[model samples]
Target: MIDKQEQSLNVKMYINGEWRESSNIQKRSIINPANGSIIGYSEEATIEDAREAIKAAREAFDSGVWSNLSTGERAEFLFKIADKIIENREELARLETLDNGKPYREAEADVDDAAACFRYYAGLITKPSGQTYDVPAPIQAMVIREPIGVCGLIVPWNYPLLMGVWKIAPALAAGNTIVFKPSEVTPVTSKKLLEIFEEVELPKGVANMVLGAGSIVGNEIVENKDVDKISFTGGTVTGKHIMRTAADTVKKVSLELGGKSPNIIFADADFETAVDYALFGIYAGSGQICAAGSRILVEESIHDRFVEKFVDRANQIIVGPGSDLESEMGPLVSEEHLNKVLSYIELGKKEGAALAAGGSRLTENGLDKGYFVAPTVFVDVRQDMRIVREEIFGPVAVIQKFKNEQEAIKLANDSEYGLAGGVFTQDGAKGLRVVKKLRAGITWVNTYHFTFNEAPWGGYKQSGFGRGLGTFGLEEFQEVKQININLEVEPIGWFK
Candidate 1:
C-alpha cells in the first residue's frame, strides 16, 4: 500500500538555496513501485539551469563567505543541517520510498544514516589540524588546512538521499560550497530535504541542486571551470567520463564507482551463518546497491551444501511492491535497468551456468504491471563465466566452486572490481588472515554489508578511489597550506 503520508510534493531544482522553476519548467512522472502508477513528477533542469547552479556555487566559493567561516561555526551549521534531517525523518523516508522504489523501513534507516553522516562530520571538522614545524633557527613554518572551493556532487539513484548526505555533509563541513545533482529517477526525497531549511539555512549559494540527465546537467557541472572538485558515485563508465571532463581544468575529482564483489564461503565456515550472509549481500536493497555481493565463491567440499541453503533462502525472497513493506525485494530503478538486468540473466544461461531458481520476471501473483524481477540464483558457475565475472546489478547470485583457501582467494581476486567482499569461517584467526588477501576495500567476517558511520568506505581497482565516509572521506575536501615566517628581523631570501 502506498502510504497516504506521501504528500503530493511536485518540486523543482533548488539553486542557490532557493527553489525555482527551470526555464524549461518541464516535469516527468515518478513511478510508484507498488503498482507502477504515476505518483508525482519533478521539474526538469535545463543546461541553462545547470549553469545557474554552477554560477551560484562558484560565486559563494570565490567570495570566501562560506569558505572563510570558522571551523567551529561551520561545524555548528553542519549539526543544524543534521538536526533538520532528524526532525523530518518520517516524511523524508516516505518520499524516499516513493521515488527510489525501496522498502519503507530501509528507506527510513537510510535517512537516519544520512543524518548520522552529517553529525559525524559536523564533529569531525573541529578536529582538523595543520602541522606547525620548525623551519630554521629563526623561522617557523605553519601549515593550515583550507577548503578546496566549489564542489560538484553527482549522486546515484540507488541510494539517493544517503549518497547525497555522504558527499554534501563532508563538503559543507570542510567549508566548501556545492553544486549537486541527484539522479532524475529519485529526486523527491532530495527535494523534501531542501525544504527542511526554509527558515535558517546555509549561506545562499552554499548548497545548490540541478535536476537533469548526466549527459546534460552532470556534464555541465563537472566540466565547468568554476567547479573546483567533482565527486561522483555511479557506474564505472560514467565515472570515467566525469574524470575525463575534469581533466581540462585539472579539477580535483573523487569517484566511488562499480563493483562485482565476491562473497566467499570457506569449508571451515559456519554453514548457516554463511548462507544468511550470502543471501543478504546479493538480495538486499533489491540488489541495487553498488556493493551488492554478487559473486558467490564456495569451497569444493561444502559447495553443494552451501548452494542448497543459499538457493533456498534466495527462493523464499518475496518480489512485490516496495510499498508492501513485507516484500523482501523490490523493482529495479527503471524499465531500462530492468531490461538490462534481465538481459544478463539470459547471458548467464547461455554461458553454461545452471539456473538454480527464479530465472525470469515475476509476472505471476498479479504483478504483471510493475518492473519486478524474481530473485535468481545460478549454480555450478565457472570462474570464467560472465555471470561470475560481471556485476549483474540485480537480485541475482552466481555460485562458483573453488578447491581451497588459496583458490578461493585467487578466484575472488580475479574480478575487475574490488569494492567489497565477505569471508566465512569458524576459526576467527583464519578468517582475519584471509581477509587481508581479498584485495577489496571492505571485507566482512562471517557476514556481509557491515557498515557504520565511523568506517571509511570506497573501493579498489575499477571500483574507484577516495573514501566516502569517516575522517578520510572529509579530508578529500581540503587542501594543505604551509606558512613560513622569519622570527629573526632579518630578511630571508633564498638562503642569502
Candidate 2:
C-alpha cells in the first residue's frame, strides 16, 4: 500500500523540541531488513549535536521546566503524550514496519505497548511516596525520592520506539529530562514519534531525539558529564561498554541486556499449548528477540514425541515478506544477522545434532529476494556446543533432553545468561518449584516471552541491572534523600 511518496521520505533529528537538520550532515539509508530495500533515510548526528542535546536536557532539568512540575502536572503531560501516541499509532506502526521490517501486526502491538508504557508511568508519577519517620529523643526523620537528573536514553534497533518510551517515560515521570537516541538502523520510527509531541505541548528540550551510530552520538551521550543518568537497552557486549563509559562520569546507570532463555518441557505439559508458545518464542521475530527461547529443554520421555509434533507444527508456518499479513516468519533483520544465524545452523550440523525439519535459509517460494531464514529446529543438542551455549538471535531452536528435575534445573541454569526462561507443565506446584530454583530473572510457566506492564522485567548477573515496566521501574529513576526534622518545638536547654 505504501507508494513512492512514502518510500522517498527524509527523517530529521529532533532536538530541544524543534526539528533540526544535522549540522555535521551525513545521511544514512535506512533499509527494510525483510526486503533489503531502502525504506527511509535519516541525517546522522555528530558529537556537536550530542553536546547540544546534553546541554538542552541539562538546561531543562536545572531550569525546572520539566523536573519542577507538580506530579499531577507531569502526570497530565504523560497522559497527553499517550493520547498523542494513540493518534499517531497507525503512522508510527507504518514507520516501524518500514524501518525495522517487522510485520504490521507485530509492530502495531509494539506501538500499543509504547502507549501503555507511558500510561503506566503516568499513573506512577503521583505515587512515589515520601515517608515520614518517627524517632524518639525529640527527633523526627523523613525520606524523599527525587529524580536522578538529565537522562541519556539509548535504545536498540530491534524495538526502537517501544524501548524509547520505556526508558524515557519513567525518567520523565520521576521528573527528569531526557535526550533519547534511537539506533541508526531504525531511527525514523522514533523520529516520527517525536512529531506526536508537537501538539502535546511538552516543554522544549524536555524530550529530545538524536540520531547516529552508537560509536559516535551514542558514545557522546554516555561519556558526557552533563548527562546524569544513562538508561541503555542493547547487547551485553555494548552494555558493558556503556557501563565502563558511564563510570567515568559516575552517572546513574540502568541496563537491559541480551538473553538466551531456556524453554523447558516437562512430561506433564500440554504439548499443544507448549508447542504453540514455543514457536512464538523462537520464531516470532525471526528469532531476533533478546528473550527468544533459543534453548529448549525437553524431558527424555517426551523428547522424541515433542520434536515430531513441533516440526510438523513449525512446517505449517508461512515464511515471506513481513508486509504479508499471512506470513508467520520473516527474514532476520539484516544480511549480517542472517549469516550469523546460518553459521549457528551449520554449527549444529557439524556438531552432530539431528536436524528435524529446517536447517538452512529458504529460497523456494516466490520470495527469493528477501533476507529470509526458514524456521529451524535442531534435536539432540548438547549444552557445550556454540549453538547451545551462545545467544543465537535467530529462528533456530535447539532441543536438548533432560532426565530428571535436577538435570532440568541444571541445564536451564547452565548458561552464562540469567535473563529469562520458560517451564511448561500442567502441575503449577511443580512448575513453580522448578522455576524458583532456576536462575533467570523472568520465568514463565506454561509460557515463554510474553511480558506484561504490571510485572518488573530485567535479568540477573551479566544479563544486566535494573527492571522495566512497573513500580520497581520507578525506583530506577530516583535517588533516596532522607530529611531530619526536630518535632520537639520546645527548645532544648543546651541548644538554647
Candidate 3:
C-alpha cells in the first residue's frame, strides 16, 4: 500500500532516460477520483518538451543503439522489464487504483496483464520465421520484417498503465524507439513505468514519456515528421484528428478507439451464468472499458427475466473508494466525467427508456466529495436511442429486446461502432452462428469483456482500425520488405 507521504511525491516527465519537469515548468494536479483529493502533480509538457522527446526517439532509432540490438537481446531486455513489473506489482496496482479510481483487485489484475503482455511479446520476438516465396526461374525471394523506426504512443486514462504497456511492449519488442504520452488525468502509473524502464537499464532515448494535454504534447507527437508511426488508444473524435494530422507525413497509424459494444443474451442460455456475466460486463471498471458491453440485446423470450436479475445484481454492487479491498466499484475518474454520465442518464429518460434501477448520483454518507454514480440499468430502449448508440463510459447498461436471430444481428450491427460483442447461449451451433453474423472484431460465446494476451483485439468499423494484442500487434510496429535474389546473375530484358 502507498503511504500518505509516497502519494504526495511529485511526478515528472521522462525523456532520454532522465526525469524532468516541462520546459515551461507548467504543472497539473493529479487527483484521486475516489475522494476528489489531489494526490500529486505532473508536468504539463510544452510543445518543445514533446519535440525533444520525439527527437530523442528518432536519434536513438537512427543511431541503432537500441533498434539494432539482436532480436534475442531485445527479448532479454523485455523479460527484465517484465520481471521488474512483477517485483513491483503491488505498488503499481496501488498507484493505478489511486490514479484511475478502479477497485484494487481490478487494478492488480491489470498489472498482471501488463507484465504478461511484455512476456508474450518477448517470446514472439525470438520465434523465428519470415515468409519464403518459391520463385520461378533461377531466383530466390523472401520477406524480411524490420522495425518501423520511431513510434509515438498516445494512451488513454481508462486503463493507464496497461494501455501504455499494450503499445510499448509490442513496439519495443519489434525494435522500435518510442515517445509516449500518458493521459494527463492519470499519469501516476505511467511515471512509475518509466522508472522501471530506467531500472531495467534500457538505453537512453529508447523509451520516453511526456505528460501533458492533447493540444500541445499530443499534437506535437502526431505532426512531428521524425516520428514514423502513431499508436493511439482514445475516443473516436480524437482518433480521426490524429489520422488527419499524421497524413501530412503519411506515417503508419494504428488506432483502438471508442465502442458501444452489444451483449446479446438468448433465451436458451444458462440463466444464472448470463446474469452474472451481464453484471460483470458493464460494471467492471465502472464501464470505462472500450469493449464494454453497454448495449444489451436480449431475446424477447428472456428479456423480462434477464432484466430483473441484472438490475438486482447491479443494486448489490459495493461502490466506494478504490483503496478499500472489499469495494466492487469505485468512483468515476473525475467530477467532469460524473456530470457527463449524469446528463446521459437524463437523456435516456428523455429518449423514453425506463430506468429499471439507479439513475442519480450517490452522495449519501461520506461520499459527497467523490464522483460516485450507482450502477444504472435501463430497459425499454430502442435501437436508435442515443443511450443505445453512444459509448457511455460509465456503469450504465441499456437493455433492448430482439425478436429473433436476424433482428438480433441487425440491432447489434446497427451502431457505427463495432469493437466487440458477445452472445450467451448453451447451444454450440447457435453461438457459432450468431458470432459469425456480428460485425465485430471479437465476439464471446459465453463471456463478455474478457481479453487475453494471446488473442488479437481491435475493431471492424469506425470503432478503430488496427489490432492491439498478440503477434498482429507486433506486426503493427514492423515494416515488411520483399527481397529477391538472382541465382544466375542474369540481367532483366526490360531494364536493358
Give one digit per residue, the lDDT tens place, for model 3 in 126-232.
99858988877687999999999999999999999999999999999999999999999999999889999999899999999998999889999999999999999
Please estimate how well model 1 matches the true structure, expressed as its whole-model Cα lDDT: 0.85
Residue range 1-496, candidate 2, lDDT tens digits = 3322266768887788888888865698877776677776788898999899889889989999988899999999889989888888888887777777777788889999999999988987787598987777577888999998888899887888888888888888999999999888888778767877767888998888888889999999999999988888889999999999999989988898988889899999998998899889898878888888988899999988898999998888888766777777767777777888888888889998889878877877655556788889988777788888888888889889999989999989998888898999999999999999988889899987788777898998788999987888888888899998776687567863
For model 1, residues 1-496, the per-residue Cα lDDT tens digits are: 6566454657688888788888885677787655577877787888899999989988998898888888889888878878888888877887787777888878889989998998999889898488889655777889988899999999999999999989988998898999989998888888876776454567788889888788988998888888899999999999889888899999999999999998888898888888888888988888989899888888988988888887778888887776676777888878878899899999988998889988888877867877888889998777788887877788988888888888888988998998998998998988988899988898899889979879999999999989988888888998889898877785557674
Clashes of each: 0, 0, 0
Pick out the ten consecutive residues of candidate 3 with the lowest summed lDDT.
Answer: 1-10
- Model 3 gets an lDDT of 0.91
Pairs with backbone N, CA or C atoms under 3 Å apart (clashes), candidate 2: none
TM-score of each: 0.97, 0.96, 0.98
Model 3 stretches astray by more than 4 angstroms: 1-7, 490-496
Runs with alpha carbons beyond 4 Å of true place in candidate 1:
5-7, 493-496
Q: Could you say which candidate leads in lDDT?
A: 3
Strongest candidate by TM-score: 3
Better of 1 and 3 by TM-score: 3
lDDT of each: 0.85, 0.85, 0.91
